[model samples]
Target chain A: MPEPLLARSALRAHVAPEIAAPAPGVVLRERTDLTLASVAAFKGREAELADAVRSAYGIELPTTPTRVAAGEVAFVWAGPGKWLATATGPVDFSTLPAAVADQSDGRSVLSVSGERARETLATLIAIDLHPRAFTSGDAALTHAASISVHLWQTDDAPTYEIAVFRSYAATLWRWLVHAGQSRGIDAKL
Target chain B: MRIACPHCGLRGVDEFAYFGDASVTRPAADAAETAFADYVYLRDNPAGAHRELWSHALGCQSWLVVTRDTRSHAIETVEAARDVALARTSEAQS
Candidate 1:
């Protein structure tokens, strides 16, 4: 294999030196290796696009406003006639009238988990973080710390991924750390 | 205020960004000047239920047509704007 290129975290020097498990119930970590892409079906091509995605990725393209994941391949309902797809490795979509673009660099993801994770998020956002309402596999574009974030619950143990603009990574990290302090956060850098 | 996003369920008002008057549709360019002007600039400020467009900015980012009671701030119906627009376009073409 060819030598791998060096990739730097959006949080760079900020999260580098050490990965600390700061407090108690909350575990904070920055997930930088995932790949993300914006996928949109062109005008008059919705059905064909869905079929193509199903064939290409071995997963259905969600038409309804919901997030669905099959293993490491996940589709996030972004807007009308559009979805954002994320996967663990390289992402490619070969279909007519379908637009796919790399969004991995544009977005920075922060993962938070543990018992009080829901409570910690609730303190920052005005949305209802009730388990019954925002369940596992559910995703939404919402504001936290006054910044636009795509928040999703990956599993029932109250694990969440907050994806924000790479430019706002430091700010979001600070906000998360502060909010999670009360719940005792174990920050992994 | 809370708006029920059809796909995402009930969420706080802060997650949504509002656009006015989903009830309005632009007139054909060649139509009467006054009609075009009305469609572009005039909007109703109703005290009761109103139909308006709201984007779920913090989630899904989908445009929704929300039927809400202006006085009580209660949402009566919420739907994906794409469906509504597609229906209207097809109906007009048909």
Candidate 2:
């Protein structure tokens, strides 16, 4: 008989669900319930794959480095031939024509919200996070805290969802926590 | 240096992984030893505009061909490397 299995979040050992009002303007929280998957179009099958995704999920798999949402599922273009999809609950892509792989356990997600969130992100990412530049629903794969991470502007309050490999999550979280110290942080870990 | 990625806009150099000289062409498999050696070991250290392959490792993950002035670090143009290479192949065949 197979041994019993247990599942744990990437931040299980790093963060706990609690709010720390470190300063007056920022709130950091672990995005614990995200479900992620990497979807890539098979070679020479781009259009067909996209049609299948749209028909199945009711949203276009973005072609450029942008983000789009329909209901609970959010899609971010990962690159030319690929996209990453995220939802608050389990998302099954088995019916789509694209190659889909589970990334829910492969990444750690964090959300930094509040009025000062953009300013805080600027200290780590070089991209123009200004609302004029990276407005709501915008996403990009970028370097932050010296690690490759995906960042998305989820709301007008300038909330951001940062997704990084599980291995780099701890280091990135530490950097973010430190960066927010000056402005004070409302951490909901 | 900052590169204006076609898809993701201007981004820091740290987000990219550079591989020098996109202009380099691999010698044919049956080419002479000298030709293969040159392909493997030789590269031009151009003083002016140079084209190189840069993979946006952190964002978009698109491989781009960036043409920039080395002396001033001014980027001239950026395009998808796959598109450029495919165009080149078709151009050569034509």
Candidate 3:
């Protein structure tokens, strides 16, 4: 398959990494609900928004998009000046670039990774998360983990999750476990 | 790709549509059809920063001008530009 985006340098530069857990370990977990901190921002002037996002969050978006027309995604627009990015994976919040700013309402992140991580998620997420179609650096909004979440497949982290509200963390985690039980993914974390 | 429209907020990248080369001006239709054909078809498939136009067909339904790089898959700029503004900008010399 094609190489995943956010390679060695990029992942190190952006991911807010925590130590990887053992195989079959608790790969997915959500901390106590913390108020949502801004996760993204945009700046334009000489077409510097990508740089801005890189400088701010260390994530890079594709340019001169050559894919088929994306006229269907606009159906969810809720504001005039901002779009909420799906925040997932390990984030290094302290390194957020100064050029960009975060303006998200109270939101938080969830961590999901482990040997059984894929199997675990497969039970709950109706969609696919294979490396080919939903590999790292890809983001999708879906109803999974028992909540509406912005899913991010982190680079090399071997973990993934749905970025959801603090209130939904517990329920989502519970759902993740239930889905995995059949496959023996009784992750306690 | 989920693009955050400066005017329409965060929307799926699919909702916004792409236009032709943003920096190139469409040749006159009355002129040689061949040159116009080349204008319409031939393009510089560059590896770096490229400016193009896009429209939010599913969201605000407004036109936008964007600057992006192909090699790196990095978005440079996504701006709200009307048809007239984009045309004028395309016509301007660097």
Candidate 4:
């Protein structure tokens, strides 16, 4: 069999060196909910959420420089004026960007591909994904079943990323599992 | 939508992107802060045809003016930055 085009370990490194490969057949769970987000600060004006988080804490989050291909990186927009770049690590969520990084808060990063990804997401998402409205790199930040999840088409893989508040990750995961089971597919990760 | 981005050639909706209304008039030189804020932030989402500014940020990265229906998402016009300025006044009057 041809080797897997992408090594999850390599991909993980591309996001963060601290995020090593998943254990053999064991996906990383400590940071079970994986998503990429960022905050692009322009002259330190516009919006801020990370700065506030940092003022309260003393750690800085990882941030990828803009203009690089998102293909080589996993990132997401965390807010209207910011983004959040993520990977596995005991990240200091309180860290904030200094300049433009300091201005914007972030946007969203959504997981949209998985064995039964579409089927699982269909329960909450409303955008028409039938080849017409969705293709690779197609993203939308709208309500899926009244819940806001930034949707993005991951590199044509079966695992997609979705971003939601920390409070709803479990509920969203449960919904995905239920939907996946209905399709005779088990979405364990 | 796959726009023929002036800079990046042709890219998917993910490569290029959208901005808000393009025809809204800018605030005058001594406009109040609130008025200026409204001009900069508020979008005129008319139900019918509208001129909107879009960018191929992930593509060629040039500014584009696209005429699309606010309700139906039908595009009636697509032009580069230079031409979009020409239609600005006519759009504001409509």
TM-score of chain A of 3: 0.54
Query: Residue A151 lDDT in model 2?
Result: 87
- Give every collision pair in model 1: A23-A185, A24-A184, A140-B59, A141-B58, A141-B59, A142-B58
Question: Against the true structure, what is each candidate's TM-score?
Answer: 0.84, 0.93, 0.42, 0.42
Question: Interface Cα RMSD for candidate 1?
Answer: 2.7
Tell me the tens digit of each residue's lDDT in model 3 across A151-171: 656554567745565556556
Model 2 misplacement above 4 A:
A15-24
Q: Where in model 1 is the C-alpha error above 4 Å?
A: A1-6, A15-23, A64-66, A93-97
Tens digit per residue, CA lDDT, model 2, B1-94: 8889888888888888998899989887899999988988999999999999999877787899999999999999999998998999999899
- Compared with the true structure, all predictions reach lDDT values of 0.81, 0.84, 0.52, 0.49
Query: How high a TM-score does candidate 3 get?
Result: 0.42
**Reference contacts recovered by each candidate, as fractions?**
0.72, 0.86, 0.07, 0.00
Instruction: Give one digit per residue, the lDDT tens place, for model 4 in A30-140.
Output: 134343344455544433544553444332322311221222333444333444545443334335443323101132233445445565666656555555656555554
Question: What tens digits encode model 2's per-residue C-alpha lDDT throughout A43-160?
Answer: 9999998788787778887877788898888888888888888888777865568889988889989899888888888899888888888888888888887788898888998789
* Candidate structures ordered by TM-score, highest first: 2, 1, 4, 3
Better of 1 and 3 by lDDT: 1
Candidate number with greatest DockQ: 2
Name the candidate, 1 or 4, with the larger TM-score value: 1
